[model samples]
Target: MKLSRPLVLLAVGAVVALALLAGIAYIFKLPPFREKGEIKAGEVCSSLGSSSNAVDALTKVLPEESSYSFDENIDLRTDVTDTNFESSCFVAGGGKQLLVAKARLMEDESATSWTQWVKGTASNEVSIQSLTPFTAGDTAVSSSRFAAVFVPCTSAGKAPGGQYNLSVSTELKQEGNTNDAAARDELIKLAKNAASYAHVKAKCDMAPNLGGTS
Candidate 1:
């Protein structure tokens, strides 16, 4: 059967409109409204590197008065899986002092949740004398005059169901001018900066404590 002129014209107009919309979308790179996720978390990180920003983050924490610099060879590495991401960097300063800044990302599951503060194991060989809370994470000061922090990145609102952990360890570093007190302070500051840069939540009022006496 032959089609009516008006009906054929209407059909042609609809096709042209669709084609024009498609061309506009392609030119402007406009994604459809019903893409996938709601673009939650603003921008979820993916290109977190090991030596790139990790080294800068670690170096920024070093005390200016201390005679320390990143060794000629920095032992830093990073890894990422479907459910986890981690970055670590080793720092050397004052001839015999060492510090490590590490960050971890994992699914926001109950068992491995990053919100709570967990104490580290301490024994004769590994003696964590004090465990306290920092503004951005947990702090542990060891008997060997060591300092560290375990931070969970939960400040960005819990939309994606994942958390972040930023840990700093100075247990291996020998006694130097920068004692546990100073090292602990530095680590806490580092954590605060990390929270801001990485868009994580931090509890600054939780100010770190030495747990025991002072």
Candidate 2:
């Protein structure tokens, strides 16, 4: 039987709409479209929507097209946040890659270890060759493509000297570009921003006199 003109037109329109919908779905699956997201941990980082600059800087490690996500768990005691953190709120432009992580400064050993490391590297005392945007905080440090910002905070537990377990820190370590001041500066921005997110999370208020994060 011959179909009416209106029926044929309607069929054609339906086919077109289906095709459009399919195209949209396919685009979203591609990395550039699909991988453009960060799992926000809320508070300061809530505003950390996917876009450019920091994320672009961070994704420099990815040779191919890239995407990113942010996470919050950090432990300074074991240095897991810096050395082993699978992800970060940090974004960098290192030749290879970079990461941001959080940790607690609960003891003198860790404090000395972390802070001294930054001071030495930032001052050029050490030679892995990192530069600085160098945002100052309660105590920040630098090393071979490594930077960490420490925010003062106290956890519930007490320390050996009757001190409270304190500090929320972020480490932005790049696999390369240790000597590029501009790149280091970007990493500093990324690190500080990540530290700020942690500062809010930690509820750090112990040293407001020392100029806490904004």
Candidate 3:
């Protein structure tokens, strides 16, 4: 039996409408398409979140007698992230050092999920030496004189999701004789201290092995 012309036209219209709806749904599912909140960026020398928190989380790990400078010498270049919070520090004395800390308030991220993000970020580097797992978070140390540690945390001691990444780079002065081994150890110390933040401890416990290059 031959279908009427009007009936065939009606069928085609229905198919077109369904396809358009599917496209819209897919767009909304992407990260960029979702609602975005304001991202705050500042260059304060001390304090983490507010004025009362006297301790400066970013520079707490540096060695004693090392003077802290705000955004004057360090350059993150292409590694900069557009997250909710970010801080950078440059320390001089024992050696010229650069440290960067970044945080994202993800509402739905697991240890496994954030681990992948960190690994993916490091995969493209020239050489990745180790990716060790620890109680607080996973640490990735590269022979390139750089280290990154990622710790899962909460936004404000309230659960949902929060994750942070701390990366440090060490550069010896032209006439200095410090070795990379000493600098690498210092970087690890910084990472451990950063993970001790109240917000990080609130969410991070004896985290399970999330498998990385280590």
Q: What is the TM-score of each candidate against the true structure?
A: 0.38, 0.44, 0.37
lDDT of each: 0.39, 0.43, 0.38
Deviation (Å) of 130 in candidate 3? 4.4
Model 3 RMSD in angstroms:
21.1
Candidate 2 overall lDDT versus native: 0.43
Judge candidate 1 at residue 137 and give its lDDT: 43
Worst 10 residues of 2 by lDDT: 78-87
Q: Comparing 1 and 3 by lDDT, which wins?
A: 1
The clash number for model 1 is 1
Q: Given candidate 2, what's the lDDT at residue 139?
A: 58
Clashes of 2: 8
Report the C-alpha displacement of residue 177, candidate 2, in angstroms: 7.8
* Tens digit of per-residue lDDT, candidate 1, span 39-118: 11222122112233433433444433233443222222222212233444344543543554344443333323332322
Clashing pairs in 3: none
* Residues 1-214, model 2: lDDT tens digits: 9999999999999999988877886776653344433422332233122234345545432223233344333432322122111123443321333354444444323556655554543322332344332446555554434556555444333223432323333334434433455445544555555555444444443442223322
Off by over 4 Å in 2: 1-64, 69-100, 108-113, 116-135, 155-179, 208-214
**Tens-digit lDDT track for model 3 on 1-214?**
9889999999999999988877786676433233322112344322123312212322333333323343432222121132233333333333444344333223334556755565554323432345444443444333323444554433333332343333222221121223555545444444344334323323333341223211
